[model samples]
Target: MAQDVLESPLVLLDEVRAGLQGGTMVPYLGPGISALREQEAPMAPEALADFFASKTTLPKRARGNPWAAAQYIESYRFRDTVTLWMQEAFAAPVPPSPFHLWLAGLSLPLIVDTWYAGEMRAALAGQSDWAEVQGITRAGIGEDRWFRFYDEEGTSIDADQAAKARTLLYTPHGCIVPEANFLISDADYVEVLTEIDIQTPIPEEVRQRRTGMSFVFLGCHFHDQLLRTYARQVMKRSSDHHYIVVDPETLTRNERRFLDEQGIIAIDMPLAEAIERLLT
Candidate 1:
């Protein structure tokens, strides 16, 4: 319960330290973090418009709300353009943003992100030298599909390397191994939300093994359904976690109020700036 906890900057950092000791804290990332370097990446509104154009075979609109198109498509086409775009976007590699670098500096135990592949990998590549001990878990398609990835063909981030580095990255939604199985689409997004609801703050077993834990959230826009699902899960599970959510624009009054109310420390800064503050 947020009410039972004391909300202060120093106090919050102390809570993060406590989670480090207790191993209950974890980070839940979102799409905004991807934009840390890809400033050219289309905004959510733009992505929505593009999705509509792709679905209806209509010309892309110069200016229009993408969510409107999303609503229309959901009601009409029921296609997976939004999901496709994310998969394609993440499939390609990009440079690490500041937020990613900041994360590298922190020796947190475990990190959970909604990122697909590209930018995060880029970030990891840059931070590989500093990341002596870390673990990452991703939500893949299904348990069977995920195990197959580890079994049939191993990953570039092998278990040996992971064990040596003390890192355990996962794609709970399935990785590139079974491209088709990678969860996407509005329904897949919904499934991610469902998982957050059911099994989050991660399980206790995971926490005990993880040490110096604190969730340093980066680049995530907290309003999406998937994010909200994670937020609710985090809120319900533990108040001892640390969250540093970065956004380009400063939070609106309502947004600030909401984060303050929820006990989430919202960092109003660009991903580059956030990384600068966190890392070098």
Candidate 2:
């Protein structure tokens, strides 16, 4: 086993930083990375359901499912308005989280934002000229990279000129904007399998840099097979060099087994503390 197999979050963060600086670590961003203070971030599924209820009554089945709630609300009502409202809920007047600012400054070669959100992208944009490849935003950063494989398809910014700026943000689940690109129901989840082409863009430069590297999954929840898949994708190198940071409160027996099976080092701590370790 690697010497870091059982290190504390502090030590683990240090190791991760070394890999990142050495061009051997990829930081995968997720919704969990958001420190949505005073803003409407779903602390839990129920909280999201309650918030969605204010806009339109969500069926009991859709109680804990924001995607379903959002999809259902948009089906009969205004899709653009609903998605924009959800985006605004995140875009509310809150300063960027310290973790994001720290992440933006890092010279990492590549960043894979699973689903789309403009918050981190916007924050990072302030730090560097992050090229948004296949994105969905009102005003794009520049011409899309080769990763924008599908033309004018799901989450394409041109889908709606008035939708919202910096709208494309990829989460562990999928894109949060664009009603068509939304991964809400079961079909949507399965659909991601078919569209795996645009999943993770490893630029030739990034690929070379990633050799024998590790991964640090930020704002990721790894308590189930669903979220576990996110860890597997980014750490596909088949080496025991990846680590997952999840809230200790949410860690489960099943999650433990999944991590062990995948050879992943799991840190049962909150991101705030982990980031502090990295900063100091």
Candidate 3:
């Protein structure tokens, strides 16, 4: 089908809702989703970069880049300092949004959260059928592993154990809870990015669950190349048709191109408005 024919917001919302109820649409959440909460958690990359800069002096080139700022801190102060900052930045509790609660009720095979906050885990706390698979940084660990699995109680588990859960929460960028595992600095991503295209870093459970599923991208922006690349690789081998709720007027040229290239239908509306309609 042509992109123009699928540009109807009402029609797209109906399809997305149906997909959610039917368990074929995975929710791909971004950091901006944290903005729905009243509390502050440095939701955006730029905001996080600024937060790091505030704590330590960063060169002008790394001012607004979270990865660069983190790299600078890791190089100068040490990796422990970077982890401390991340833990402090996300220490405050952020209540889950309505969408999170709605999703928690469903029997989703997989949910990809690309941020470090613990709200998603909190939202799923009421359920016992879920587990988390997060990307781990290769800085200090002597083990040759790229990811870790944790059951609802946050105890470390094997991949076989995680695969048995009805719902799997995949955090590609790591989270603050359970353990302070973050992939923010330049060195952290160097290994993951190198193998992401080949699906080496992605867990087997995630890859199998996402095989024939569609994705509903919420609170996501693809203006940066790194963001675009991660989205592309994560959704690789999934169903062709996907939906991204975005304000058409605010899309960057690169973002628009990415949507077109990825067979994603852009629903033009505010995030809150779209979420409201999705719930209805």
Candidate 4:
């Protein structure tokens, strides 16, 4: 990642400022953020998910759909096996990147990310006070339990005990928490979809943070409806306050429609450039 491009002089800084000063900006991060590490480590959950799906038989129609492919494989009673794979892959400690560090340093009101490796807390370390909420899944003999991971200390705490106190790092998707266990399959997604609906009883704290907030989606890919559906967990489907950064060439029609219908705006730019603007 070119930290230089991520410096100031961003074309979108004015727009980002509008969201910030208005008290509506919430940063939504994703797997591509970790890939930004480039040379340090490879903690991309998409790749991990791909590795699991590759070992099993994915339905023909689900060729490019990882979650769907996993669901197809789960139908064969191998979900637990897949969970184990996730556990081992996500258990290691992967350091947060400069982008993560800068974001955490800001101590923004709300930060939402889908990087299930639990790296945000570490990224926010020593910068400001922080709380983390991760949706974790544990598999039993024949069942899976979906629960939230909210520990005051979060994966770690850093030097500046004072500034480090007030940030909230959230992972809306299921994490491996212990290893090889996560929310995978059509059934798991159904639960997530329901959990984010209007009637679902989400935590008062989470609800409070998400309500009345505008969003800046960075390094995210809403390629699947399930993912777009998942976004509802953060903001309403009809919300126009949310904005996603994208590489225009890769943005498909369905992707644009899903975002548009939900009132989410798309900004065409590479992730690094977008992140830089937001930071500025």
Model 1: what TM-score?
A: 0.57
lDDT of 3 by residue, 1-280 (tens): 2454357888888999999999999999987777866667888888899899889889998999999999999999999999999999999877788788889889799999988887788889988799999999999999889999999999999999999999999998999989989999999998889999899999989999999899999999999898999999989999989999888778888988898888888887788888999888
- Sort every candidate by TM-score, greatest first: 3, 4, 2, 1
- Tens-place lDDT per residue, model 4, 1-280, is 1222243434445666567555568877888877776523235545754665556666676566656666766677576665655565566677776777777767587778776665676776666456665554433435343444444544433323322436666676655442323566666667656656763524345566777777777778777777777776667522365666666568778786776666566665777766666566
Best by lDDT: 3
Q: Model 2, range 1-280, lDDT digits (tens) per residue?
A: 2333456776677777787666566677666656445445544444555667777777887676665676667666656655565565444433457766766667455555653443455456565333333322221225343233111233333323312222222233434432323333333344444444454332333334345667777776555454566456545553566777775446688776776676667665677677677766
> For model 2, what is the error of residue 279's alpha carbon versus the real structure, in angstroms, after optimal superposition?
0.7
Between candidates 1 and 4, the lDDT winner: 4
lDDT of 4 at 214: 77
Model 3 weakest lDDT span, ten residues long: 1-10
- TM-score of model 3 (CA atoms): 0.97
Query: CA lDDT, every prediction?
Result: 0.45, 0.53, 0.90, 0.61
lDDT of 3 at 153: 96
- Which stretches in model 4 have alpha-carbon errors above 4 Å? 1-11, 17-23, 39-46, 57-62, 138-146, 152-165, 177-181, 199-201, 237-239, 277-280
Off by over 4 Å in 2: 1-6, 40-47, 74-82, 91-94, 114-117, 134-187, 195-212, 247-249
